[model samples]
Target: MRALFWLLSIFALAAGLAIVARYNDAYALFVWPPWRLHISLNLLAILSVGLFALLYMATRLVARALALPGAVAAFRAQQRKQRSIQALRDAQRFLVEGRYGRAHAQADAAYRANESPGLAALIAARASHAMREHVRCEEWLRRAAEHDREVRVARLMTEAEFAVADRRFDVAAERLDALRQGGHRHIAALRLSVQTAAARGMWGDVLRLARQLASHRAFTAEQAAPLVRRAHLESLRELEGNPEGMVRYWRQIPKPERNDRGLVRDAALLLNASGQGELAAEAIGDALDDNWDSALAELYGRIEGGTLIERIGQAERWLRAQPRDERLLLTLGRLCLQQQLWGKAQSYLEASLSVAPSRAAHLELARLAEQLDRNELALKHFRSAAELTG
Candidate 1:
């Protein structure tokens, strides 16, 4: 529609000009060097318009010629940039595919092209590490650091992972420490630190990180259970033979962990081994009141050197709640025996044997019979215990 309008306007203007030229006679005369010349004003105006159009076309041609070199250079630069981007993408794909050699080559190409050089160098470093080219890996990491300061965290994390993989726990620990000091303690870093500590047998560190990871939801409660349990158990084991240290360590554990029956039981046993029998008995008594474990109840009776009356009272209270538990009866019998309550001890031990027929119960009854000077009863109980042991 616009083209039609322009065509019609041009025709109308031409018709009007033709009508004017035909009706009005206009002339122009010029002389130079004694020569006379004459031309119509319309012809002179037509020549002037044609000359302006030619000059405008010539100027445009000259401008285009002058700008050609820069345009060609821009096109070449665009091609190089595209190639660099493609190389970077290829490097990423190869890395994911586990094609370390190809990935390293592609990443090197990308780095040479200066396309995100830091990230490319990091990729190269990882590939080199995968291929066991330690020297090359270190060099690439150094280059990555030089190229981009923003990749410092990434560089350290990668190095720490490799250190862990190579069993260089000290190196991994150093790297993790640097990460923490630099405020780079993300979930990934925390996980790596946990693994490093575990590999180094740094149980205390492992326990600390496992708690942190659980709180951060890095792992579910079920998934983190074994790690938490093992770390805490191992840490307790390290405090063996030192009653003061064991007590201090137990006190230092979080209340929730300290309250765990398994932990409490182990801690108590360790305390018992360290000759803190009173403390050991106290720990077991508190745990039994909160939650009952048959094995733990049995362990409670083995603790000595505490107040016999108080311990007997504690066992009797538990018996009221668990009337039929054979282990509880056995524990009560042992505690009564320690207090020299022969009649009560014999009755409880016999009741335990009636309930479970355990060798331990029979043996305890045999000892009680011997204390009462009943050689015949003691011999009978010992024979029964031997049969049960068989």
Candidate 2:
């Protein structure tokens, strides 16, 4: 409607102009040095109008021609972007569908197409690793590393994990050590590094990494404590036959942690194996202060210079505190047998059996009865023990 209004207005102005031209009879005269001409005002107006139309058309044609190349380039760039997006989608679909071979192909195509090279390289690496293609995985990981320096640490860490998965522990360790030395000690990277070190029996490195992980809360105290202790234990084991060095290594552990039941138990067993019974007993006693364990009870029972009566008294005290504790009752009964308190031993053994019958408890009780010359009771307990053991 606006265009129509403007067109009618232009027509009315032209008619008014024509009427004015008729009345005035004015003409426009043109002179070039060699020629002179004259035209009616209306005709000149018409000619001017036609010339303006021609100029406008020509300007539009020139502008369109000027923009053609850039327009084409932009269109082509958009098409390339679309194709790259499609390729990435296809690669992701293949990966999700467990079509690793196709995923590899699609990722390679995406990479060659210059579509997010880093992402494509990562996809190819993961797909190859899934297929157990270690060489291909490494190549893709290396390519990813070369493409983006910012992701170099992450790529190298991935390669190290793959090496560890492939049981190439030495290579994994080398890569991990290099990354750590370069200050790329991300938590996952450090964890894999520790595992690699452990696989290679590098207990010192394992201990160091475990401590670092523990400090950062990457692992819980309970989880990391054992690994640290095991690393120390292995270090001590390596120094076996060198008693002085072993003792020094064992003593290096902090008092509080060294006194932990699990750590102390393992240390005691190790010391005992190395003919360090006195130290083993001391460690055992230290562990027993915090927690009572049947294994520790048995270990304590084997020590000398403590009479059977004293040991029995200790076991009875423990049992009194936990009357229904079958293991403690059994231990007490065995201690009583050692002290030749046959009646008390029988009573404790019967209580243990009533709480939780076990072949071992029955056997101990039968042995005690036999020693006390209660033949009938001994025979019956022996038959029960035999039945349970069978």
Candidate 3:
């Protein structure tokens, strides 16, 4: 529509000029010093218009020629940027495809092209690590640190993980310490620290990190159970020489873990050895209350001191509920023996034998006979105990 308007305007102007030209005949004379020339005014106007059009075209051509170099530079820059983006994308794809060599190549190209240089370098480093090119991996990590300071957290995390993979626990620990000092204690970093600490046999750190992660719901109960249990077991061994330390640690363990039969058994044995019979008995009593195990009942009898009446009463109560449990009866007998109630001890041991003639029951009866100075009965019980292969 705009083109049509301009076209009509041009035609109208031409017709007006034609009518004017037709109505009047005009001429102009140009005189040079030596010659004189005559021309029409309309022709002079046409000549001036033609000269203006030629000059305009000439100026446009010159301007285009002068701007050509800058235009070409801008075009090349755009092309490089596109190539760099493609390289970075291809690198990520190759990394996911497990083509380490190709991923490293593409990432190197991206880095050289300066497209997200820090990210490119880290990608190359990961690929190198996968390929077992340790030197190259370290070099790329160094380049990553140099290229972008903002990626310090990422670089340190990567370095620490790779070091852990290599079993260079000390190096991994150092990297993690540096990361913590830099104040990047996100869940992922904490998880990595857990792995590193576990690898280095740093059970203390493992326990601390596991608890922290658990609070954040970072792992489910099923997933965290073994980790927490292992940490506790290791920590137990760590405090082997410090009985008070063991006591403090035991009390801090959650109630559910304290009810684990296996854990309670180990803990009881350790506590007994450390002269903490009361706590040991308490732990055993708590575990037995949760779940009955014959082995734990037997272990209960072996613990000698620490509120003997309480432990005896607890065992007798369990015996009331499980009258035929030989191990529980034997434990009752042992507890009676500890309190010097010879008649009760002998009676319980005999009842245990009547229920199930086990070697442990006979052995306890034999010990009771000796305590009461019945040599013939002690000899008979000893011979009976010798026949069983317990």
By summed lDDT, the worst window of 10 consecutive residues in model 2 runs over 298-307
lDDT of 2 by residue, 79-187 (tens): 9888887887899899889999999998998899888888889889989999988789879987897677556666777678788988999888888878878987789
**Residue range 1-390, candidate 3, lDDT tens digits:** 999999999999999999998876788999998999999988988899999999999999999999999999999999999999999999999999999999999999999999999999999999999999989998999899996575788888889889888989899889989989988898888888888888878887887888889889997767666677778888888888898999999999989878777678888888888888888888888888888898999899998568778788889899888888888888999999989888888888888899889888887888888887898989998899999964
Model 1: lDDT to the true structure: 0.88
In model 2, which runs have C-alpha deviations exceeding 4 angstroms? Answer: 1-27, 32-57, 66-70, 89-97, 138-151, 221-229, 232-268, 275-313, 337-347, 369-380
| Alpha-carbon TM-score of each model against the true structure | 0.75, 0.75, 0.71
Tell me how many clashing residue pairs each candidate has: 0, 0, 0
Error of 1 at 98 (Å): 3.6
Alpha-carbon lDDT, every model: 0.88, 0.81, 0.88
- Report how far off residue 350 is in candidate 1 (Å): 6.1
The reply for model 1, stretches above 4 Å from the true place, is: 1-62, 148-150, 197-241, 324-326, 337-390
Cα lDDT, model 3, residue 79: 99
